[model samples]
Target: MNTFPIIETERLILREATCKDADDMYSYLSDKEVVKHMGLEPYQTSTDVLEEINWYQSIRKEGTGIRWGITLKGKDVVIGSCGFLNMQPRHYRTEIGFELSKLYWGKGIAKEALNAVMSYGYKHFELERIEALIEPLNSASQRLVEKQGFTKEGILRHYEYTCGKFDDLYMYSMLKAEFELG
Candidate 1:
């Protein structure tokens, strides 16, 4: 499967991530506030970001997951990363995750990137469902998925361990038909 696709939105570009993007990606991944709810510690250095990009590339090669760097239309730096996770063609489903720089928060950049990704999943990948797992306290992520037409199914208790404790997550999903209605 062609896992890495360059998707463009009016204000954003979702392109395959690479080691060259380490510096730009590290700018956000190193911020505690940006990764607080994403179950990852702030990266201590750009080398960590480089390793992460390599891992992302490997997974895309294996057809398991695909992560994209989110860049502004006119900018050359990545402001964030977003993509499909645990892609299961047999089940026609995949989970989505995203993280944006705190500097770009509240600008709707995430929504723009996610919408493009989900549209690709439904149209090109023939996905029947797209899911999101949001920490209970991460209202912003919940709102992002909700705004994209995903319905909250329920909460998964102790869904993930992050920041030294087990965190509950709200499960949300949007079906292909639901996305088409929008």
Candidate 2:
């Protein structure tokens, strides 16, 4: 993870996120609909976006995880982001998370970007499992993972505490063997 990987797909580019992405990132993260199930409150200021960007930087330096800012091909504006976090290298596993602007909903951009990221994780990191913890009420996320060949392994009760409360999450996972079969 010394050099962040820039993944290019047919219609999108997943590049290292930078401070310059703060504005575009804020536009979506500040939206209530975008943050509702993300276990986060809508960011109210640029400072919040800075903290988010800093975390992205720290993860890369720490070799813990990496998130690429999602941009449309030929465009620099970051519409959303998708990547791994809570990575456990010793265990050969990590958690996947993503968010998109409401404006990009249903466009299949997420699927394309995730395909690239997940493939990188498996091939480069030699990951055995990539998992997602989706808020129970988020059907769209559940469907996205399902479409990607992830298996639903049932609910994890009170799995995380965020935004001032405990939340249950649906655990979905895709193993290297399963992804190879994809």
What TM-score fits each model? 0.95, 0.97
Cα distance off (Å), candidate 2, residue 96:
0.5
Candidate 1 stretches with Cα past 4 Å from truth are 1-3
The CA lDDT at 155 in model 2 is: 95
The residue-by-residue lDDT of candidate 1 on 1-182, one tens digit each, is 64357898999888988888888999999999898898889999999998789878877877777888999998989999889888998999999989999999998899898989889889987999999999988989988888888999999999888778999999999999999998
Error of 1 at 62 (Å): 1.9
lDDT of each: 0.89, 0.92
> What are the per-residue Cα lDDT tens digits for candidate 2 across 41-77?
9999866898899988898778888889999999999
Lowest lDDT 10-residue stretch of candidate 2: 1-10
Report the error of model 2 at residue 1, Å: 6.8
